[model samples]
Target chain A: MNKLKNTFYPLTAPKLFITDKLMRLLLMGAASTSVLVVCLIFLFLFKEAGPFAFKPGLGKLLDSQWIPVSFQQERFGVGSLLSGSALVTALAMLVTVPISVLVAIYIAEIARPGEREFLKPFIEILASIPSVVLGFFGLLVVAPLVKATFGLSTGLTALTGALLLSLMAIPTIISLSEDALVSVPYALKNASLALGASQLQTIFRVTLPAALPGIVAAVMLGIGRVIGETMAVLMVTGNAAILTASPLSSVRTMTATIAAEMGEVPFGSIHYQALFWIGIILLVITFALNIVAQRVLKKYGMMK
Target chain B: MNNTADKFILLSLRLITYAIVLVVGYILFDIIRNGFSALNWQFVSSFPRRSGAAGGIFPAIVGTFYLVVGTIAVSLPLGVGGAIYLAEYAEQNRFNSLIRLAIITLAGVPSIVFGLFGLGIFVLFFGFGPSILAGSLTLACMVLPTIIVASEESLRAVPKGFRDASLALGATKWEMIRTNVLPYSLSGMITGAILGIGRAAGETAPILLTVAAFYLPRLPKSVFDQVMALPYHLYILATQHPEAERIRHMQYGTALILLLLVLGLSLGAILLRTHSRKKFRW
Candidate 1:
């Protein structure tokens, strides 16, 4: 295009023709790495976990006691871990979903142009804050506050973990569902307004419905984060592994089980195998959640 | 009456947003303010004394720096190459969608699972042991989805006319991408990488099983040697240490340092992304 263009490296016949096959192969291999990684993770988890995962009998998994480290009798029951994870995740979602949707609506519909622009990136920064740091906040700050507020013996209960996890989850929900709310067709909201609906009604009744799939996907992704979080829950949940769902009680989550115990266990021991089994269960749960979220995101034509 | 109801709802929403923002602000402020006392010249430079009670965290800082470098080296090319194939070359089909599905699934499969995978495969099957090499490769896998998604978005953001112009000047397809497309998208790609750096640096789980050492106060001589990291250091001090009450300030300082490191990188990425968007607009 330029009258006298000077190129540092000009393409030659050998260079042009020679790289086509190599480039194609390399790029193909690069793309396939994702699939390969996922497959290998599942294979490795199952291989390490299969023998003892079934040795305890599938029915025994519901025994409400997890004594994997017992010298007297080793049992690989996952009931308490599963329930504990569920309770923490449920508490997190109860706080995350509604507030996230509200924040999304506020940013997308109510905030001024400048405010919207400022708020979106602010949410991204919030999302970028690491989980371990949040765990730190929970351990030093929120746990003490929760203890003071409720007159509990210790602050590091399931509630403290849930509260911090909710904090960690909120930004993901906000950023994603904000995209969803923004993508709802403008005409739909305008039509509601034209038919004598209030601006709030237009947003809640029309725009929110149109964006529900995307919002749901966002919530699912947030749940995925909550369920998989390790450091924060491990730090603050007290790691008692009890068979209760009370928010005020100490608990242990499956992810926490792996992170807390993996280092101390002897290699190839039943305890080690049971941790891998926890890993397998975690993988399957998260995989299911993500698949549903991906399908919803794809169906909504919302991916940018 | 209608206006009053609408106004009330809007006010409530604004309050909720305020509450959420306040929590984040509170956490950051609490960390920085309480931990500021621990940030001294000696603290950042000297080695930990008495197992992380009163001394510095130089080894942990250096280890985290090395992990970031190793992660970028391993992930940048693979992520960019894969994204380029998807955005420029791959046809839209079931197989391509399956690839997308696989990437998303991998991303959401949890860091703890990645930790296990690293322990099983890298530490055992591949015989790398609990070293920087295993941790970096595992983190490379974990960050691949973020990098690929970001790179593909930026690549797609490049104007199609530039590619056409390059091809019209008798340039081959590869040459077109090399000179015209990549230059415009480079900022976005770097932004993605910076964000990944932040995540990789602050992450505890994947490295917990792979590379992080509990009490290695000295700097690592090579990738094969285990090293202490700020995240795992903080984890140990807060949760497992017998003297958790005694060295609480050091724990806050470590948290503050990790937070600042990750937050600084993320801030750079957000700014660069804003800059890229402004520059790429027609």
Candidate 2:
């Protein structure tokens, strides 16, 4: 096809038909625009948050007192929000990751073709539902159920948020982990089975280890999602911004803090900058995980 | 012993999978139980208030519609155009690779960060303070990457022969794009736009910063007027309310409506995707 096209066009010189300069320029221009958007966002966030960088925030960040009354006494405590987010996300991941990996293993290695076909789309539907809707469901149904079972005061708690988040994260973990497990070459699993290894043993010893990097990427993506989630956490987290280790206690998250405070915060103030600082924290955490995931993916890609 | 243990493990996994499915079903059923009972024309049309729990979601419904429309208006052109340029013109090199990386990065950026960006740029700098325009623009940016990637994949799927044939017939690059490629790829582009709309409709963060009035019982008079979105309303009614009875009704009704809107949009996309997959399958 390439030869036929060249013969027909009869290119006599470098610039005869399609020029490299035009293609490269267009590609470069498009790439530059995206980078520009990213740069502009970072610059805007940092410029707004410059003052808070100098505000000596070890005490403020560490302390539980999050009272930002005015510019005079602007002591914002993000410890609770950070810990709350981490707790909820950790709980959710604890529940989701194992179940997701199990399902991935089931579908990829154990399930017959028909079952895999049937179950995969069902999981995808779960992913397609928006987060806000999930929050609403949690608030209405899961929260009440938790309250009744656990004898809690209100329906909203870290437990409810974690439950909903687990559901949301499962799809990510399952899909990606399944892709990883599926991509592991058949020969390794076959050899393990031929050598008298049980199917589960084969998966654990050979296939799982081979797919370890991709599985890590999948779990990181799940963590990235939990950290960034806003609406669901805001709805079900009780939004109290209190520091608590108890899953039953009503607490707020870093993302929830921004959502709750952004509307009320005075423009270009320390309180506002504090929110940007949260954004900075979130960016750093997720960006680091993303880079790690990228390296893992690259390693796995090279393996394949 | 090993066989029995294996059987038990498989049984437990199957049970857990079934339980997850049941959870999803339970959520939908709960929503329906509350929402369906109150979902009359009066509830749909009238304004919500303290006394009238089932009065209406008039403002919220309208607000959501405006949000979807505004987001589509802002994101569709840019997303589709960028996808076209990327798929058609760009070579697979460092430049295109950078573009891909930017898109993945954009997707991972927290929605809360976008909310902050909206607060700083749209509400503060542009002075579209706490209005629909600000909310919509923020959502537009949020959905842009999804649209770009979806449309790009579809465009890339278009065979190279079509482009070659159009060029052979003395068609300019722009003409070929306008006529040959676009016609074939219209369904894919529309699907992407619809998926973008679905995402924008359910977004709470950007709107939380941009618009998302706590009250606003009345329907928005225009884009300038403050409005209460369904998700924001649910958030308020869930957390802020002092009364438990009020909370119950509000929570259930809001949950149902939100689920309907989100599921409606998402199911539409899934159906389209499934249909397209079937149609395209040889």
Candidate 3:
């Protein structure tokens, strides 16, 4: 039987075995590339940002002004930028979370099958619109309307940025929250309904509570997206590093600061290092948010 | 009283949903309504004049095309191979879970951070130097997580019976995957790839630092040459141009083209996904 098999298959089992081993190695290498890339990103960002941390010291980051290009003295205080990012993200979340959760609930529970099909794709399309295009819309269309309504001079304020950012973030929250809502076992809803609850009551009392963890995860992810967004905010936020809480005032996010300054700052200069340091901060924030979000989903068995 | 409250709440939800839809519709209508006046055959086919304030956006379109192709080339194989390993080979353990965490983190990394990383690695370390090669690699890294997740889901969707049957018939593991597994999952993989392409094409931040030129209207002869991209082009026109106000028409035109390209890719992916669902039942 061995001789017959050898005659039929000229390529020996040893050769096939070697080929399989090589392929597995190649595939493993490919799989591990993502981990390697993540490591390299942290490494390089820290490498560039390290020098600035030492020479300037981390205290400079706490200063309230961000005049990096001043002729006599350059300040790298990120307080205002941090405040700006926080303000925009906070405002965006304030607007986005309620609307997106409601939309998710509507789609998951209230919409007819045909309406769900129509609305789902519409939201996905909204998600896929390029940020730059939305920024352009904000610049020409929304900015003007905002300026006229608020009687602001420039119209590029935190409010405008927050509104557009909320738009950008809405799709993410809705989709993920929709998934969370849909995953609630029918038994829970049926029980709520059998207990003399209406559809709205069942959704609000049973489904909403069950999906809360997932909804929180979705909102965190949305906040991460809003915080990390660069181009749109840069174009629409007026790029002012002002320490203010008013949404009508111009603000500069850490992301917009890096994007706006990185292009002009000489390589290896303090300004460049400052940008890299900002990159590190952004990376760490988003990383933490993502990890927490994933943990929430995993702990609740909301994600596969 | 309870009935009135429920009616109000449901009515508010329905109104808000419709409002969201209308906002999206208005944005689209605004762009298409204004963009048509600026778009002409000559505008799309001819090269820019006077720093993109006048003339066509041919080079930007071509550059974007080159980028999408390059991104596909670099990412598709790596993503698919990674998916195969994860779906078929990896043991469920701490290490694999760590890999999953890394992918999730990578996906959540901001695009600008990706740009900075690309600058450090490809543009400086590898000496690709602000070129399409650097940009494509950057985008590939950005989109890798998406492709991996999508492809893995598709791979997992194939029934285990097919694989068992092939292996039971005396085929090697690779032979079983090649003959019975991969063919069925290719369409789904392609659908994911298209979604990734849509994202890569639309992203401006990664390319801004790594590859995009401010006004290089000429087509790149080599991957090393910096090329103008659609998103960056619109950005400069809308924000940085000295004649930004004068060039409103051009800005709208560029925005329209980019909007169509990205939305069209997304639409195609959606269609392809539905078609694959209908065709492949098992």
Candidate 4:
């Protein structure tokens, strides 16, 4: 028996050991690819963007007018695009935050069990609807409605984009804030009720305060999404790169500028490089927002 | 008076919730109402004529199918492998923490930025030249975080006793995971991958710069060739086409198809997840 076992075991054990080590190495390499890709994204964006710093110079980005196609000269100001993004994102948050928070409250606190089950997945379906379709809806349906309602010559305005963006932002904020509200320990609610607090009072005074950090994180993440959103804004907002604070006016965002011009711009030209520079700006802003949100979640132990 | 105020507030919240639901319902209703008329067998099977104002959307449909195939090919193995490493092997350490951070950051990076990265790396550096290969690679990166997170969650859900039993029976670690862990977690992983593919299918920004063609009415002969995707096609039809107003029916038709594709995949994922939970109770 010992001799048979020795012969059988020696042949397979070493082979299995070798394969196990190899597989682990392969998986580790696969896991590390994300890190590598992140590094490459940073490198490539800066490499392509580096040329603009020398020719048009970084200072040119501050100019308020963005006219890449012109007869005599080109202007690569990113200020207008920045303001456009800010205007749309601000308006979208204004609309989304209140509605999402209330809906989240209803889903987590007020709904019956069966209703919660149905509502959660229903909202997820809303989340799953493609942004491009949303953009299409905005273009054909919402844009016309806006044009008629506001007495504007055109339906395509910053407000039109804002409304569509609000639709997109709603799912994200509701889901995350719902998770926050749900995670608030039941014991706290029980204690609040035990103190003779009304259901509304308990939710507002106890649950909302406890889940504030997660809700804030959720809102920040939603804003990150709005700021980075491209196609919907590109379609709904009239692609005019002019600085304006009015929601009723046509404006172009940083994302829209890149998507619109990258197709037509000559490769390796300053215009091309400027688009990459804008990409870098977008990368930095979204990265900072994500890191901050992650930090908040981690600090509050709400990451799960 | 306080009770009356509380009652009023709760009622207002309920009304607002229903209104949000109504708005979403209206959007879907409007699309189906308008788009159903334009969708036909001829429209689905034929190629476009007159700058997409009059032809069928066969080429765009085929292009999106190819993209979904290619994205699944590239992302699934890497994402699942990454998940296995994180869930089964890695210890608590700074390096692992950094990898987690990278995954989170990757998830939050804007889709347009992904387009730029794909343009710079695959198109420019690797010389794929804005083809399906480049676009698939770009999308794989974008959706990797979702797959990894979901897969790891499922992997962790398998009972520790199973792993211990396999080990006690003299099975190698890899053998144990292969036979015991992966089988159970596969449905969850596929659900995550399907969701990722859905996102890839709907994405226009990343493909806009990497792979999508403006008016390619023919099917791509190879991965190197650019093709017309449904989302990008819808964008062109709705906004960029010179006869955008005249082609309103076509725009709605494309939107309907794309919406059905994405939402159908998501619904499948949700259903599969529920079914798996029922089947794999332990």
Candidate 5:
């Protein structure tokens, strides 16, 4: 085909086909636009955030208060929000990682074919549920239960936010982890079984290890979703930017800070810059998580 | 003894899986029970009265519809075009990997950050203000990664043999992609776009900082107008309403509508994907 095309190609260099070259370049330009958008996000964030982001020398971010709208001496200490985000994310990951991994294993190794079919779609549907509804549910259901159980002043706490976020992250974890587990070679499991290993042991000792990298990728995805969740956490988290580690404490997250405060802040104000700085931080962290996940998948030969 | 232990472990896993299912069931049941009470046609069609103390979420519904339409317009063409480049044209090299990395990174960026980007670039920088245009562009960027990845996967699913055959029959690569690859992969692409729309409709974060209003309960006159969206409206009612506890049923109703809209689109996508897989099975 190459020879035939060359013979018919205006009797010159094949690359001299201006139309073909132009079309290829057009596609490449469109494709690279995604990269350009990514660059633009980072640049725009930094451009908007740079002045205030550096004014506090980065360590002021560790200050224990976050009163960006004060009558005097506005404090941009994200410590409270950072701690809140950490506390909620830690609790959320603690619940979701185990449950989601177990769910993936069940779907991959234990569930009957009929069960698998139903479970997959059900999970997808669960993922499709809006975060706001989950937030509402947390406010209505989980918050009250937590408050009643713990004898708290209000149900709004890191616990409520974490619980809802864990629910939200589960589907991402289960789906991706299940994909990895499903791709594990059947022959490897069979070999373990033939060696007198129990079905459970084969799954645990062989399949899980083989799928480890992909599972890591899945967990990273869950981490990305959980930390980035805004509405549910914003609603149930009490929005109190307090520097406390207790799950019972009402704390704000970096995301909730932006959403709750950005609406009222004057454009180009220092407060606006502070919020953009938080966004830049989020962009960096999530980008890092995503790149690491992609690298893991590529290394495991699962990424195309 | 080992068999018994394995049985216990497997049983526990299955129980947890069922627990997850039950959790989902409980949420749906709760939403429906409360939302059903306030879901009369009057509530659905009428504008809010008494400063959201009573009446319907009509403007929110309309605004969300407009945003979804605008988002699909912006994302679909670019996403499909980029996917075509990735699947058909790009060589296996550093540049391609970098593009993939960018897509993955874009996908993972928190929607709030996209909200910020939209605030910076679209609203402030481009002077679109807090309007529907800003919100749609923000959402389009956010969903573009999903569309690109899904479309690329579908494009890959189109058998290389088809492309080869087209080329052998004297078709250019562009011709082969348009007539052969695109037609076959379109179902998957549309499925992806459907899922993207669902996400876009359900999203509050991107719009919160870009175009969502605190309580503007009227439909917008143009793309430059700020509008009330369902997710943001629900958020306000759930958390910020001074009488949030009093308007509980109304909040649930809005949530239920948003939930149904999003879930319906996602269900449609899943069904189409299943159908496409069966039809295109090698």
Candidate 6:
């Protein structure tokens, strides 16, 4: 121990010390900078939202009215905002998770060697495409197709947003679940097969069970992506800011509401603060999902 | 219980996987056919908003380039510097762990949140007023986590022998990293930059809040001048006025160009990463 210390410890120790102290400074700067930015946003948002909270607006936040035009009758509700975001995200995850899991299964077990080679990188390429471009494609291609088939005049709707978001979430689900699936020991699979368990049975009972933690993690990650998606949802979801269960109806998600309105909403007003509150909601939801993901992974013996 | 059923299930799995591949391929092909073939010299060189049939994306392209350059300039140093500090200097402790958690949290923070933050701080507070600088700085913060993670992986990939040999040669810790560690890790560092650029190019929200001028500024003379980016231009053209035939065409043309840029960069990074892994047998 003494000899090792002598080797590392130096006479002058490079007085312009670049190691320990420099690292602390750099980390502190990066961490504080990130936290500070988010904190400031919340602070500013609440400052603006206070007036709306105290003034007793025309309607409660859960009330359906959103007319802010009349000076004597101002009303804003975020219930639809929350529901619209939730409904779209839920639909997206529903579509994305199964498809992603199947792909993960195929890659992890079913694909022939040559097929795996071709398919893996192709999926990666799909993932690397940008969200804006995805939104554009949804607008021009997917939206029009839906409108034509569904007897709608235009493409922008909850269904369009859900479809686009599903595409966005697939890569995350597939990738993380693939990691989890692969982490299932080969010995386990071999043992199951050796016991005369059919391939499908082995996968469902052993491989998948062993990989359940990872699968859950992937689902949570996809939830994060779907819930937080903005531009594509904004462009394709018709921005109607209404409550509807019908997938074809034009609606606005919480994310879309913030993005579409922030440009026109006067700063430091009730509406502006409400948008920040929406942001706060978004941050909380995603953060909770991430924590849940961590917990699920931990329970399943999956390492962080 | 039945061999036929087992074979059918296996075959169906294969078929489903193939279907996924074909769908993705068709999407790419359609993008190329509809979006790519529209690219022209006039489209590449002319400024935006010719009103009727003469719209082009010269300024949007320039705006993209400027945003990318500025973002890279800001993010690369800070990200790689932070990564080096984490990997090289920081001891495995609570504080370091907390910072790691912060980075992971930062990574999870949505792009729109980053946009809101950017809007509040850079645009409104500092009075940068939704300029390119604000857009670029916001993007810089957004991509920083990616760069840090990628570079840290690269730094970790360096063989321990290299470090031991440098130490035996009486080299200081900084000298060891500067001369040997960095050179060996340059390929990975470059790969991270490429990935970061691809991401920044596709980002729409931050640009929407920050720069994304509704009308093209004939051309930007300085960083402060508001100008349209390709994604922003595409958003406007897609959402606000699809009625304009010329603007509609410009949207497809712009989308094609932006897709090409992002796809090309992503492919290049993947290739570089693959090649490096092969070269190093990593």
Worst 10 residues of 3 chain B by lDDT: B170-179
Clashing pairs in 6: none
Off by over 4 Å in 6: A1-60, A70-72, B51-53, B242-247
**Whole-model lDDT, model 6:** 0.80
lDDT of 1 by residue, A176-253 (tens): 898899899888888899999888888888999999999999999999989999999999999998889699999999
lDDT of 1 by residue, B1-48 (tens): 978887888999999988877777788888999889878889889999
Is model 4 an incorrect, acceptable, medium or high docking prediction? Answer: high
Candidate 3 docking quality: incorrect, acceptable, medium or high: high
- Candidate 1 docking class: medium
CA lDDT of each candidate?
A: 0.88, 0.79, 0.93, 0.93, 0.89, 0.80
Write the residue-wise lDDT of candidate 4 on B40-146 in tens digits.
99999999998799979999999999999999999999999999999999999998998998998999999999999999999999999989999999999999999
In the range A95-210, model 5's lDDT, one tens digit per residue, is 99999999999999899999998888887677889888888899999999999999999999999899999999999999999999999988999999999988888899999999
TM-score of 6: 0.92
Q: Which 10-residue span in candidate 6 chain B carries the lowest summed lDDT?
A: B46-55
- The full ranking of all candidates by lDDT, starting with the best, is 4, 3, 5, 1, 6, 2
RMSD of each: 3.0, 4.6, 1.1, 1.1, 3.1, 3.6
lDDT of 3 by residue, A1-304 (tens): 9988887677677777788888888988898988999999999998877788789788888799999988899999888999999999999999999999999999999999999999999987788988999999999988998999999899999999999999999999999999999999999999999999999989999999999999999999999999999889999999999999999999999999888888898888888988898899999999999999999999999887
Residue A222, candidate 6: C-alpha displacement in angstroms = 0.9
Residue runs of model 5 more than 4 Å from their true location after superposition: A1-22, A53-59
DockQ of each: 0.80, 0.37, 0.83, 0.85, 0.68, 0.50
Going through the candidates in order, what fraction of the true interface contacts does each contain? 0.79, 0.42, 0.73, 0.82, 0.77, 0.46
Per-candidate TM-scores read 0.96, 0.88, 0.98, 0.99, 0.95, 0.92
- Could you tell which candidate, 1 or 4, scores higher by TM-score? 4
